[model samples]
Target: MKKTLIAAFICSLSATPALAKTEIQFWHAMGGALGEKVEDVVAGFNASQNEYQVNASYRGNYNDTMTAAIAAFRSNQQPAIVQVYEVGTATMMAAEGAIYPTYQLMEEFSKGFDQSDYLSSVTGYYADQNGNMLSMPFNSSTPVLYYNKGAFAKAGLPDRGPATWAEMEEFGQKLLDAGYACGFTTAWQSWIHLENLSARHNVPFASKENGFGGTDAELQFNGPVQVAHIEKMGEWQKAGIFSYSGRTNEGSAKFYSEECGMYTESSAGYAGINANAQFEFGVSSLPYWDNAIETPQNTIIGGATLWTLRGHDDDAYRTVAAFYDYLSDPVVQADWHQFTGYLPITYSAIKLSEEQGFYEQNPGTDTSIKQMTSVEPTENSTGLRLGNFPQIRGIIDESLESVWNGTASAQEALDRAVSRGNEQLRRFERANR
Candidate 1:
């Protein structure tokens, strides 16, 4: 009877199932090599714990991923986490109950979470009016100048990037004289030329502190500084010294192919540029117009942040909080900063990278960080909060293209862009309100 009872107990134990882990879905927009890195990071996080499993999915590019999230939210199938680009900040902020603010998420589930640990320049972009962070900053980057060192040497120019717009023009001429078909090219035309340009010059891209004060702000980028820069770029386009690539990152190919001697693009482009460029390249701070301001203000960031969405259970949110904690580790962040060209979002990650001598070994890797923290960000330079900014960017792109192709003057194009963009802002205001 004892043997039979023991056998029955063993059978019952064998029939019982082990506790299943909570699965969390994270949707992101990082593609190509960056996509692989995201998977690796997610894998590391998964390996670190057994209570939850995180499945990272590359939905598409930034806009597509954000659209998917919104659609999913409407259908009651949103993921726990979604990566939304900086341009989508205003849209996400106006989503009301659609998102769970990162600040609140951390406060509720994380222990000893300190918001001050993150870089202010980065977190400031995604923060609410009260200074609470709305989304978790990730893959933040600022624009910088990338020069072909080999091409510079061949052109008999200095081994450094141009410091000012005038100097850049001179360098472009020299590069052209040296037989380069294109002297310089830029990616994200509106972003690099108008948005960052206004911020660096301490000019308002829009009224009411660039929309941070209220949603009723209007576009103001047609000011003197912005007009002059675009006019100069138009002249360069006419002279064949500047190549007008598409509105997005299509200009990167012009640089990678060594047809252009200088390129202005996001610091996050380091990985791809490093992989493709056969010749040596150097990174420098984004060039400014000496006449714009005596000293340039800090530039704004252009990258995506992780926003925790609604429609998930508390257990899933707890898992997300745990994953965020893992992501905040200095070692993990440092690795990300080194491998990718994105800024280390936290001060500890910066220190850890410094200790590891990453900045020393990889020259110019800290250029973006330096440019972003070069000065105390003013009301105009902190960041933009304009609604429908992505569509507004499309307007700016069309306007700039008209100038580049010689169909419109700088002032006219910009004036038109401002007028059209304001309409977008008004529509967004009415809808969101």
Candidate 2:
């Protein structure tokens, strides 16, 4: 009887299942110092509630993260949340039944829905025609002018940052004359040169809502303003006013080492920059074209948003929604903005920072936000919403590379880039429609 009772108890215990935590896996592109901030946000969310545990994973860069999510979704092993870059907006939207819209997710799963809390400019980009926001804008940023103070001093130029592209060109030439290897270099050349440059000069990169309204829109990057800027940059190149760093921001190493006078990169570059710079530096509004039609419209956001993936259980969705709420909390959001160079996606976070004198203490840190909000975002100023934008950007990269290397003239390259990019859009439009 004793052995029987003992055996029965052991069997009962063996048959019991382990208690499961409502697991929420978040796949993101943030790595290096950026990955650490992501983990910190996840940890904060996990600690805020025991009902849900958010597990953050770094999947690679933006493209890699999206590719992994698609594969995972196809295999029914997708995470509750996946962070995708701004370029992936249309692709994510086209992936029918794959993502749960953030506004809808907030209502279906959480009590923490506050659409009014988000910045109008940031959230408006990921929204639909009727102004319904889809993804939660998490790490929104714009390109800024990052100048090496040391380079300016060495060039005998005032330690002040240039306010216009013409001024920037002069400054760049001065640095080159002073024996600097490359006076300027940048990452995301298309983003800096074409998209942001277009908007900052109040020109359109495409028609039909910057490719948002319809996928059939063609790239108009060869317009007079764009062509002029490209040709000017090309002329500067031949004159040694600018230098090629590489295809991508990989050559951004020159800027980080204080070799370049000015570097145009995403504002999210702050963490790596703050850690690596051997000399003092500052940021300014991205230099604009002076005579180009009404300059300083608004810069488009870069970075990514937290896209909630489907095919997960209710428990998983609930956890993901709760994590989003946690990330959107005022204190949490404010800390994120200050800690990273990313813009606070919420209005309250900006107000809180102002109340706390965060911006007052840190001059130039708010330039991106100010530049974005300086004017009401018309259809043109809001942001780009292109299909296969990453691929199109690559075409631009090739065109620009040719111009820089003297293989193709600016107008010729841009015209060709537009033609090839429109073909890709035609493909996307056919499939989506």
Candidate 3:
């Protein structure tokens, strides 16, 4: 009778099945080391829980990933979560019924979630009119001055980045005299040169407070401040003080190669710059036009945010909220911010980082943070909300390239870009309205 009972118990145990974990799909634009870090983050979350498994896919670069998500949404096969660049905020906001607002998702599913916990400068870019956050802030960055310390020493200049455009010019001349092939170059010419430049100078990039007011807003970046700045860059190009690397981050290579003595790029570029540069580098605040403003205002961000899409079931969304909650933990955020050189999104994360001595040990790592928080954001510095912004950026890129190549004057190029960009705004308004 004992043998019979043991056999029956074994058979019952063999008949039972293991529970399956719910699967969540995540699409992202991060590649290379950042991509590896994304995978590790997902693995950490998966290991921490048994109820849900997140499968993160590297779709491509920012534009490609966004395109893929839109295509997938149209096919009814979209991922549960997608990372969209900061510039895409307006387009995503205009996509009615496509997004599951982060505020609503967290309020409904996650406990102890406070929108106030996030940095207002970071969240304000992704928030609605009522100040409700639409997406989760991830990898936020602002442009800063990156200088080759070795070159600065060689040039007999001070061991610091230029505080104003005039100082930058003087530093550029000294760098050139020090035998650097290029004195300075910048990534994302439109973002760093015109957009943030205008904001720092308290000038409008477009009317309607840079389109935060409504879709009827028009381009106003061709103002005197913008035109004069571009004209100065054009002159620098002629003088070999400024090299036109490209419209995007191709300029980083110039800095990495030590061909350019100084670079104006995203703070997140620290990861690559630190990894590749054989010599030491120092970071500082983005240069401003002292003549335009008595003091520089806060610069805008340039990285991406994570947006939850519609069409996912409640269970999947619950898992997403859980994942987001995990991601928002001060420890987790501090780790990500330290590893990636992105901004710590929440005050707690910043405090945790400070307590960890990450900034003190890293030296210039806190420059971007200080540049962002040093001044309260003005209406011009709050953030841009232009529609079809990606396309508008392309227009501005072409126009700037024309100036760099000496084919058009600053006034002519900007006027043409403004005209062309306004057409895109009109088209975006018609489609979304």
Candidate 4:
């Protein structure tokens, strides 16, 4: 009887298993094809380790997801990680005691986290004045020009897109003469036409280091460079060379439909363009004003970063850090960049892609990289960090619409936008302070 009891106890002890991995919740706003890419990353991380499992929940668009996160945080149900758009940087930074700085989190949990591995242009946008990263740059992107090779051929223009604004206008005239309905169009009008325009020209878009310096930063986009560019775009509109197609990416439809010969949009527009456009297309550096400065400066980034939220236990935070380490892998970063058309966040990833000849096999894929990394980012070219940026973008959009509609001149519209946007900035400053 004693031997049988001992044998039963040994069998029960052998049947007992180890503790399950801690599951960490991650909330993001990626959807459609991009959402698929997010899932791919999560799957890779989950499979790479048995210590932690990351559960990604698709919240909605950037604004919607942010709202949900705020609500969740208020309710004490916040996830361990959340993806916030570039425009929301100020809001996240202002929410004291709400988020754990990713730099600190990594330091506590990941011995492998090295700031040097990250791309400077990417990290600059998400870093403090002292250059410490506040978040993990996941999907950084810059604007680029996309041209329809078929349309260019039909128009008897060079296969490559224009390098200067004058060349872009010339190509537009030829494209229009070739029976194309429009020569050029753009998505994210404010981002490409104004914010990035100022950066590329090494001009200030806002006071106080593009708003990173202090809450007192005010709009300065009403300057001569911005006015001249807007006026030129207006002239293009009057000549039927450029068409205003709504506020967002609605203009992209005009290009993919063959109505427009060229388009300026985010480098991340790759997947949609690849899947939707039937004609041959090529990507190139965004056109600059040849007379604006000697050469164009570095373009700023547009995309979201992963912020580690507070309220999570140490084990969960460690899991979040481990997941970030997995994400920082060169192979993983390269794959994400290739799949989504976003810039690789790490230098090692870019090098890995180059070694693999991904750029050679896929021409124009390196345009964003060259444009972003060719010049060391100056204070003016780093990025915008203004409060109420989404609202400010809306103000710029309305102002540009007035220009496109011929209701107001570029200078008049921009001056008005600056006036109105400054009011919002002051409001934000007061609230945050």
TM-score of each: 0.96, 0.94, 0.95, 0.96
Model 1, span 175-243: residue lDDT tens: 999999988999998889999999999999999999999899999999999999999999999998899
Please rank every candidate by lDDT, starting with the best.
1, 3, 4, 2
lDDT of 4: 0.93
Model 3 C-alpha lDDT per residue in residues 88-127, reported as the tens digit of each score: 9999998869999999999999998998889888888888
Whole-model Cα lDDT per candidate?
0.94, 0.85, 0.93, 0.93
State each model's C-alpha RMSD to the native: 3.2, 2.4, 3.4, 3.5
Task: List the candidate 2 regions with Cα displacement exceeding 4 Å.
Answer: 1-19
- Model 3 residue runs over 4 Å out of place are 1-18
Please report how far candidate 2 places residue 29 from its true position, in Å. 1.1
Write model 4 residue lDDT over 1-433, tens digit each, in one string. 9999999998888765454789989999999989988998999899998889999989999999998999999999999999999999998988869989888899899989999989989999989888989999988889999999999999999889999999999999999999999999999999899989999999999989898899899899999999999999999999989988988889889998999999999999988999999999999999999888888998999989999999989999999999999999999999999988999999999999999999998899899999999999988899989888889989999999999999999999999999999999999999998
Q: Give the TM-score of candidate 1.
A: 0.96
lDDT of 4 at 164: 92
After TM-score superposition, what is the CA distance of residue 332 in candidate 1 from its true location, in Å? 0.7
